[model samples]
Target: MNQPFDSDLPNIDAPAIGPPTTDPVPQPFEVKFATRVDRLPPYMFGRINNSLYQKRRAGDDVIDLGMGNPSDPPDPSVIQKLADAAADPGNHGYSKSNGISNLRREVASKYYRLYGVRLDPDTEVMSCLGSKEGFSHMCLALMGPGDTAIIPSPYFPVHMYGVILAAGNVVALDVADSEMFLRNVAYTCEHMAPTPKVLIVNYPHNPSSAVIEPEFFVEVVRLAKKYGFMVIHDFAYADVAFDGYRPPSFLAAKGAKDVGVEFTTMSKGYNMAGWRVGFCAGNSEMIRGLGTVKGYYDYGMFAAVQIAAIVALRETDTNVEKQSRIYQGRRDVLVSGLRRLGWDVTPPKAGMFVWAKVPEPWASSMSTMDFALKLLEEGNVAVSPGSGFGQGGEGFLRMSLVENEQRLRQAVRQISKCLG
Candidate 1:
């Protein structure tokens, strides 16, 4: 019987295996993703990005103003520190997931120096791969099914998706007017059952470049306390203000440490985006939760990067301020050019984007998504459509000031020729 078990099959040395072995050749099993991944909608920018890729491939000199990526290099001194630290053999190993004591201390020092907010490096401060990584993990740490978060309307993708991925719901309130936003937050908290678990605020906001005064955060703290919710301030653009406008720190509000944490990174002002040095401070317990999540997910930022980040934070304030000035200059050039095009463009007081309305016949004739495609197709210039942000951003385009003055000027010329 044992010998006969294989008798109907092909012989071990046979050149032809017994007439096609009719059980149908082994096929790959179907793959199913987790429910959380399934919950996500299709990529919002896929259409625009795909066309951009095709255009670039076709040898078109398409000027890209889509992402808020910095086009400049970090300060020379900071680069040197990175090289020097990288050269040291001791700096090549795994770093503390909570960041080194010195770097944490530096973060606390900056908090106190810039915002008059005290933070304990040992407990209140931790560095992240980047603020977005920290923010997403923080949402996971605090959220679960049935939990809810309140975010700004026309949110940056991560703001809404992070909560959604953590199995939480969102209430996005319009943030064009700060007072109205605060009123809506109170209204939602007052009207909704169980209320929201977290309230996220971004000053010098992305996509819209909305600015809020220091008093705005005081109201936010008051509402957080009244609503019994926590706060998460995305202070990504904290260092990139213009026309003497200083973005307020949520941590600067009294009792902010009781209910929240603030996230900051060197990506914008210091132009160290690719280096991925991010900081979180305030609400030590919340910081601890984020640290626990991060510990399981990552060892930490690279040791050499951390070492260099310390130097960047401690020694590059002048350079950081200089970079802001450079951005302000670029902002002026782009805003002026757009205004000349008869688009309703507001010059932002801070942040790296110019959120301009889709002008003229196009605004009524097409959606922002279509308008963006037309610009890319005809103008050879790329900009993000407002719909990419959310429903509130539907009638606008968010153009970055990342390109240099010359490229920005050229982009405007291209846009004019395309539309004129």
Candidate 2:
């Protein structure tokens, strides 16, 4: 105080004035995004596709069996119906967000015919751009930061990706068998704090080609009732079974509609992959939730596509059967050819895929990706590596039966030359 002139030297003894600052301020820039996007894993198919693009550009006759994309076209009559509808300029306006009434009724009737499951078209059914779109939107509508979902491992990427995109936690169960699935669901319900709110079940499952019996849905519905969780049954491959194996709908199980919803897609069944049509049926409340989210996000698909879907559902029984037989033939050709080359593989009872365990001298030496890429380079053949599905999918590979019998046989010959 006496030497006030030396204020700069003795300032350590005085209290600091105004606000305190520790670090340098950042320069103003573009806004930061929500943290959720960073949490997403890189899309596995996109990575595989990148490689495919590069090889194809390099002039390789890449036999692409990597994706489950349908190679065939829709029925000629369906196409004509679509064209007729599109010609009606009045039909080109924004369509109903929850799907047209006739299409919804057709969805209900189809479910009743295929599974003997009755549905109120107006209350329990809603159309989706595709099942994938409905699935992801349902996740957005139902889950958030504190909610969690139980998904079977080695699942279709969307089944899990939807949960992550919703900022919900995921609990995976190894779905090798019915008993394992039941035990895992019960255990998860009992042990996990803040129990899961949703459980996703896909039969004629992707990647693994695991098929579920009707009794499995009975147990699942029972667990859902007991644990107070919702079930999202993906019945996309219902019409694609083979060898006298008819996959039943989850809604056919008693009390299933009380605690869950089922998503069915025309993509696989009617060779309408690019048509972007599907439906969700079951718990009315859940359907309403999906509808609410979808209404805000979309005005629905092209009216022409919806009209054509009606024709597909009403008149495509023989076409569906023919497509199933085509897949079965491809499956037999590929499976038998691989076995002939000394690889142990099983023929799937449903779906257009063969899940195979990595075999022999290559199994121990190469990672799944390495094995897949080597096959692509050496065999000029492309198939999905199991690791792309999830960690549980490792030590295996998935081959799609999308090719015709001749092309499939050629693929097998190519594989034999590389690995056999």
Candidate 3:
């Protein structure tokens, strides 16, 4: 038996009702974000990440080779340096956004030791949260509306993302082969109206895992000087070469430092992916420009991380050699397994990826996206579809060698089953 409340009594919890007025109902608001943000392409990994999560939730063991996240841990000594620095109470203050002097000197020393490229630590070298951050900010610093930059096809997504975000136009040239790449660059330089403002290059390049000779960079520098364009060379895979191959820094070219800057990351060489430490060195102007933009955006990485990165740059040569061997071994296993199953795959000389052409059986039957999705379902193996990289990447797949060799072999076996 509940008593009814009187109608006249106040009900504080009740929603207020007012007499209808002439005002129209409030229509749902259409949110508008920056049109520059809309200009950027959708993240290509979202679908793959979602698929992997859904499959794993269903109790499936998907051998993942989708992302190039490093599998190895950094050297213990480097970690110890971080731990030691973290223990200091006074070391917790905001670090210099352009990086500490000692770390910048260490980076300069590294370039000099490895590439014979001398840089002024104070003016020409800068530290970044990672190469991606440095490169993106460099784009923001250098480019703007009505400017154009040249990017190779099947490029790292950020290459395009940075240019677009800067409101610069992108001219994507196919660099599938070395000679073709050179020819395209020359033709673009000769034919394009209003010569490009920047040219971005990567080696060992992602997805395709293409490596270039130091002589190639010499010619690139020549082209840049002639066309009056700046160059940004991403040498992130500087230490991931395989089979006695040593990747050279673009800055090693005689005139390269005059026209270009190079970005190197600790992620691949030092197995410090999550540490987010990298360096940009070469042209003083580019470094200063990026540093200016970064100053406004960040106070640099954690002091401990910067100290740890210094240790990695100064030490860790042996550790890098060991990791290279591990990636080489994984590359061997994946390449051999795929070849045995009648798929065409070339062993890459550098980088932690194998750019594989879709198997002949699936080539005619499916698009790269469809094939990638089907492989995840039937083979229980996840790979990045080539088209995810760009239009030039269509008809192929990019498989990361991030997993251990055993898992990579298992992935190949699973793919074999899918083929059957």
TM-score of 1: 0.94
Per-residue lDDT of candidate 2, residues 1-420 (tens digit): 355566347667577697656767878888876778888877766756887889899998888898899999999999999999999998899998789999999999988888888999999999999999999999999999999999988978888889999999898888888688889899999998888999999998887988888899999999999999999998889889899999989999999999999999999969999988988999999999998999899999999899999999999989999999999989999999989888889899999899988887888999888888888888988999999989999889899988889988999899989886
Pairs in clash, predicted candidate 3: none
For each candidate, what is the lDDT?
0.92, 0.90, 0.90
Tens digits of per-residue lDDT, candidate 1, 1-420, equal 336556568667657546763688788999999888999999999999999999999999999999999999998888998899889999888887999999999999998899898899999999999999999999999999999999998999999999999999999999999999999999999999999999998888988999988898888888888889999999999999999898989999998999899999989999989988898999999999998899899999888888888888899899989998999899999999988989898899999999999998999999999999999999999999999989999999999999999999999999999999
- Two-way TM-score contest, 1 vs 2, winner: 1
Query: RMSD to the native, candidate 3?
Result: 8.3
Residue 182, model 3: lDDT of 74
RMSD of each: 5.5, 4.4, 8.3
